[model samples]
Target: MSTPLIPLTLLLILTAVLVESQSIIPIRYDGFVYKKRAASTGTVLIEAFYDPVCPDSRDSWAPLKQAVDYYGTNVVSLIVHTFPLPYHDNAFVTSRALHIVNDLNVSATYHLLDAFFKHQEQFYNAQTLGMSREAVLDQVIGFASSTLGNSFKSAIKSGFNDSKTGTKTRVSFKYGCSRGVYGTPFFFVNGFLVPFNDDDTIDYNGWRKLIDPLITKKQHYPSNIF
Candidate 1:
């Protein structure tokens, strides 16, 4: 009997293939940027690919936020790309929810992102094992309502069910794949994938060591950036 066909994406993941980016012409930082800043302002452009429900992503979130706050938006601007691991049953929906939240409100998206990373366990595989996709989404919508308010619920629900949201979310995933990201919490700084710091745990100080050097004397970071 002929072996069943495996989807290309699954095969790529299984083999740990490095997919080439779709464009050689520098892909734009299209992800949802936090604390947007002007490019010429010499900001540390940070891009991260996070699987919305992944524990590692959750664990890494706080320090990442702290580092950004430490440098302040003047020195750092963060962008998020959700790369939902297909093995995580509800990962896609949660990733899509971020897209929905971003579309509705750029400012609110990060709050929702912060909330998702904070309460991600509520939507984990074990928690949602026997749940229907729609049911889990309802839970997510309710969670958004609590975090983002009741007025956001209907719009969020509609966006969740909309094809456009799914498409945009898929784009995020594909972009991550194209960037050779097979894992959650993969990061890039100034368009290059950042090597993990040797610290037992990364923190604001760890980030300073990584970012400070990038800022040249001419560019110079914020007054209190030290």
Candidate 2:
């Protein structure tokens, strides 16, 4: 005997329920996740893909920090991903050190980033500058040591060789690559890629323009949610 079919309405409802269950997207707190001062339900996530030695990335630092300071956690959250460019010989090593710093202390990671960008010239090797690779690596590690204390020196050294750190760094780089990030200082605001022109400045106004609309759009809850 053939089985009886369910009602059309019931079948549609079941399909809708299955789709909704599968569509639930989890919040990813990967990389150096920096939350705002006061997080709320409507906080927009900003994913930044940058390289420590990239000048454009360095230029983006102030504006990004300014946006967080202005909006706070109530409006936005920032996730920093290290996408060390292959051309920069010392960038990979620097990124590995940063990953360790991020794991040890999130706050100190910010300081280390600032230090790397501010004194980028000191860490450049022969590929970008006249310094040797050893000297550059030493400078980067020493900077981390100074910023995070000497006790962290051994951990940082071990992190450089640790396969886990390498895996994390590679994963971050691949994540950005999969999302069409070909250059440093690439940004995704709430999963919407922000179109950036090389000549255009990524200042507070630029960021505010992109972010304000998203925040405003998020304020309106779905009508279906009863």
Best by lDDT: 1
**lDDT of candidate 1 over 139-212, digit per residue (tens):** 98999889999999999999977998897777787777777676777888888987673223456777778887
Tell me the deviation in Å of residue 80 in model 2: 0.6
Residue 96 local lDDT, model 2 = 83
**All models, RMSD in angstroms:** 6.5, 13.2
TM for every model, in the order presented, reads 0.82, 0.78
Top candidate on TM-score is 1
Looking at model 1, the pairs that clash are none
**lDDT by residue for model 2 over 1-226, one digit each (tens)?**
0112457874565455455534443245457867423323457778888888877888888898898778855678888899887666777888888888887777788888888889776555554477666766677778789877899898887777689888677667666655656678888877888776765548998888888888777778574664
Q: Rate the local accuracy (lDDT) of all candidates.
A: 0.77, 0.73
Compute the lDDT of residue 186 as modeled in candidate 2. Answer: 84
lDDT value, candidate 2, whole model: 0.73
